[model samples]
Target: MNQLNRTTANIQTIRPIKVIQFGTGNFLRGFTDWIIDMLNEKTGFNADIQMVQVHGKRPATEVEKQEGLFHVITRGYQQGKIIDETRLITCVRGAVNPYLDYEGFLALGENPDLEWILSNTTEAGIYVDESDIDPSQPPASFPGKLTALLYRRYCKGGELLNKALHILPCELIEANGQKLKECVNAYADRWKLPDGFVAWHSRQVHYYNTLVDRIVPGYPSDEAAEIQQRLGYCDELMVVAEPFHFWAIEGPEYLKELFPTGQLGLNVLVVPDLAPYRTRKVRILNGAHTTIVPLAYLKGLRIVKEAVDDPFIGTFLQDALHSEIIPSMDMDPSGLEQFAQDVLDRFKNPFIRHQLSAIALNSVSKFRVRVLPSLIGYIRKEGKLPPCLITSLAALLVFYRGRYKGEPLPINDTEEVMAYFSDIWKSGEPYELVPRVLAMVPFWGLDLNQYPGLSNAVIREVRALLDEEKVWLV
Candidate 1:
């Protein structure tokens, strides 16, 4: 089979490089680059990407070998139909690692056509490094590198306002774009870049806080040979992702013209504020995953699909979503419910073998962020505790017992958290355990015992779960 490249794949044309992308990872390739390719084809947004490796000394050899051509294989269920499709992506012009070729990477900033900066250096990628004070060498941090690039661009273009770049960070952190801007400013201050250049950056640079959603389980090694055989091309850079993709950018409405993925039947949204959308995702999709893991795993389900397929677990998840999660949110219930249903459908996707144990990692923090908000919201709104969520909390407490059915359960958390649970569970009594856990103000942000009847309800549920009575099911 021919190696997947521009020539072997019969890809003739390449667009002008308009985007300098950081992090040549699967999530960015599968989600953002895929959208850009579609936009180029459908909306005549003729632009390509200059991929950059942010970490380590190694450049993306696959991208280099393939001449920036790869395939994104999207497989999953959406709207009750199974979707399995592949597209050859040709938007990436090439990749350069700053550590390997600092001059080449910095030279990207001088491109006259380059208007946008895109990145997904994970949540930790955006941070201030006070020691990154030299522009002569490649800085260690992502924002430091970006500040250097921006300085180069500023100097190259004589600090022209029009030369300022549109930065859209796809990092998972909240206010990622804003945080990146802060880091850049910190670097500028530390490096003592000219006042004029700093002013130009402050006035002209566009930073957009964006929320990206897609499950890009990269490099499907187990099925790579079969996939390559089907395509008749060996693609080392192939990325596997779910069909569902959404990008919510908190920016001006006019910025839509730059993207325009909405017109291409894509789920990209450019709005004045994306808090509602973020809340919706956190409360419903993430909430569902966090709520299901402990309980479903206790029920002997190892993977997400199996848990969602089981009648009892599936019903429990559904009831928790429609009855508790959605109602807890302030959005239009109809839209919320639709999104909740779609989330459930996504969970049932067979292509993604989402392990419950993986999701179980740091579940205490996950529960605090994902599920606790809805639980509190339900109490505040309806003046009562949500049954399913309350039961799930009990299940988490039970799951933290470190063993189930005389076997060690896959409980992954910090040593401190593990120790806390271990020491607390020594009582072997729900009555004693429930109150101590409930009063864990440091964990849950407040004493959960303050909520009337919360401790007692959890005690009952914990007792039920421990006894294997199935009374909660009844």
Candidate 2:
């Protein structure tokens, strides 16, 4: 079989590069780049991407070796059908690693066609690095590198509004685009860049807070042989993802004209605000995972599909989602219900082996951010504690005890979080444990014990869960 490249793939396009993407990872390739390719084909949005590697350790060797050509293999259940599709991606022009050639990386800023910047450097990518003051060298952080690039662009086109790039950060953090902008501004102030550049960035540049959803498992290692055989080529960059894809971009409606993804019946939404959508995803999808992980794992379930398939666990998840999580959010009830159902369906996707233990990592923080808001919201709305959420909270605390069925469970988290749980869990008594955990202001941002009857409910659930009593929340 031939290597997957432009020639072997019989692909040729010389579109102008309009995007400089940070992080040439699987998610971006399968989700963002795939969307761009669709836009180019369907809407005549003839724009190419120049992928820039943020991590300084190595260049984008695989992307370069394959000549920015790859395949996105979509294989999963969607709309009561198993959809298997493959598309050869051709929107990526090439790649550059700033660590190897800073000038080449900086040269991307000079491209006249460049109008947008996309990134998914993970949640930790957008931050201020006080040490990264020198702009002459490649900065150590994602925001620092982006700031350097924007400065280069600013220098090339002084006071030109069109030159300013629309930054779309796909990081999972809340207010991601705003956070990234703050980081860039912090760098500019620390490095003492020109006042004109700062003003230009503030006035012209647009940073869109975006929420991207797609499970890109990347490289189908187990089925690679069969897949490559069917495709009749060796694609080192083949990314496996689900059929369901959605991108909620918080921007002006004019973004529809700019990106035009929605024009082709794509699941992309350019809305005035992304709060509802963000809350919907975090509280429902992520919340379901965090809620199910501990309890399901304790029930001897390993993967998400198995947990969701189990009758008892399935009902528990659905009840928690529809009864508690969705009702708490201030959105269209029908829309929220549909999204919640979609989330449950995604969890039952057989093609994806989402491990419970994997989701259990940093579960303390996950619970606080993902589920706690809804739990409190339900209480405020109904004037009573949500039974399912409280049970999950107890299961979480019990799960952190780090043992189940006489075997040590894999509990991954920061040293501080782990130590805090370790110290609180030393006492075998549920009453003592519940109060201490609830008073953790640093974790939940408030004394969760303050909620009327919350401590008692949690204590009861904790005792039940610890005693190995089958106290199903639903």
Candidate 3:
């Protein structure tokens, strides 16, 4: 089979590069690049991407080898039926490693057609690195690199008005675009860059905080050969993702006309605020995952599909979401219900083997961020402990004991958390264990024992699980 490339794939039109993407990773390719490709084909948007390597000393070898051409295999359940679709993504014209070719990377900013900057450098990428003070050299952090690029653009454009670029950061962190801009400003202040450059960055440039959702399991090594054989080509950068995708961008209404993703019937939403959507996802999708994983794993379930397919565990998850999580959030009830249903359907996607143990990693922290808010909110509003949430907490503590049914559990957490659980479980008493765990301020930020009747409620469920070896459904 021929290697997947522009020529071999018969991609003719070389669109003007309008976007500079900061990570040549699977998630960006499967999500943003895919969307851009859609715009190019469906809307005549005629924009391509120039990917920049944000981290790692090595070059973007796979991108170079494939000539910035690859396929996205979207396999999952859609509308109650299994669907497998493949599309050759040709929006990425090429990639450049800033670490290797600093001049070439900076040259990207000089492009007159470039208007948007997109990034997904993980949550930790939006930070100021004081070490990246040298404008002559490539900066150490993502924001620093962006500052360098923007400064170049500012200089190239003669510091003119209305020359600002749209920065869309897809990092999972809250206020991602604001945080990235702050990092850039910090870099400028620390480096003593031109005052005009700072002014242009602040006044002209637009930074839109974005929320992106898509499960891109990149580079399916296990099924690579079969996939390549099926496609009749060898694609080094092939990315596998689910059929569902959403990009909620917090920006002005005019951005809709600029990006025009909504015009293509995509789930991309340009809203005045991303909070409700973010909260909806966090409470419904993430909260359900965090709440169900440990309990399902304890029930001898291995993967998410199996867990959700099981009648008892599935009902538990559904009740936990609709009854407790969704009701706590201040959102449209109809929209919330639909989102919850979509989440449950995504979990039941048979093509994706989402391991419970994978989701269980650092579950303590995950529970605090993902599940605890809704759990607390529901209690505050209803003036009673949510039975399913309390049971999940109880199951979490039991799971931390590190063994179930005489088999070792895939327990992964901070050493301090593991040690705390190990020391607490030494007593073999649920009544004593529940209060101590609830009072651990470092884990929960506040002593959860102070919540009215929360400790007692959790203790009851803990004792039931300890005695019965299963979640006692109330």
Candidate 2 backbone overlaps, count:
0
Q: TM-score for model 2?
A: 0.93
**On TM-score, who's better, 2 or 3?**
3
Give lDDT tens digits, candidate 1, residues 368-467: 9999999999999999999999999999999999987666888889999999999999989999889988898889999999999999999999888877
lDDT of 3 at 342: 80
Which 10-residue window of candidate 1 scores lowest in summed lDDT? 465-474
Each prediction's whole-model lDDT (CA): 0.90, 0.89, 0.89
- Checking candidate 3 for backbone clashes, the offending pairs are none
Best by TM-score: 1
Deviation of model 1 at 293, angstroms: 0.7
Alpha-carbon runs more than 4 Å astray in model 3: 158-161, 470-474
**Model 1: residue 39 alpha-carbon error in angstroms:** 0.3
The per-candidate count of clashes, in order, stands at 0, 0, 0
* CA-RMSD of model 1: 2.1
By TM-score rank, best first, the candidates go 1, 3, 2
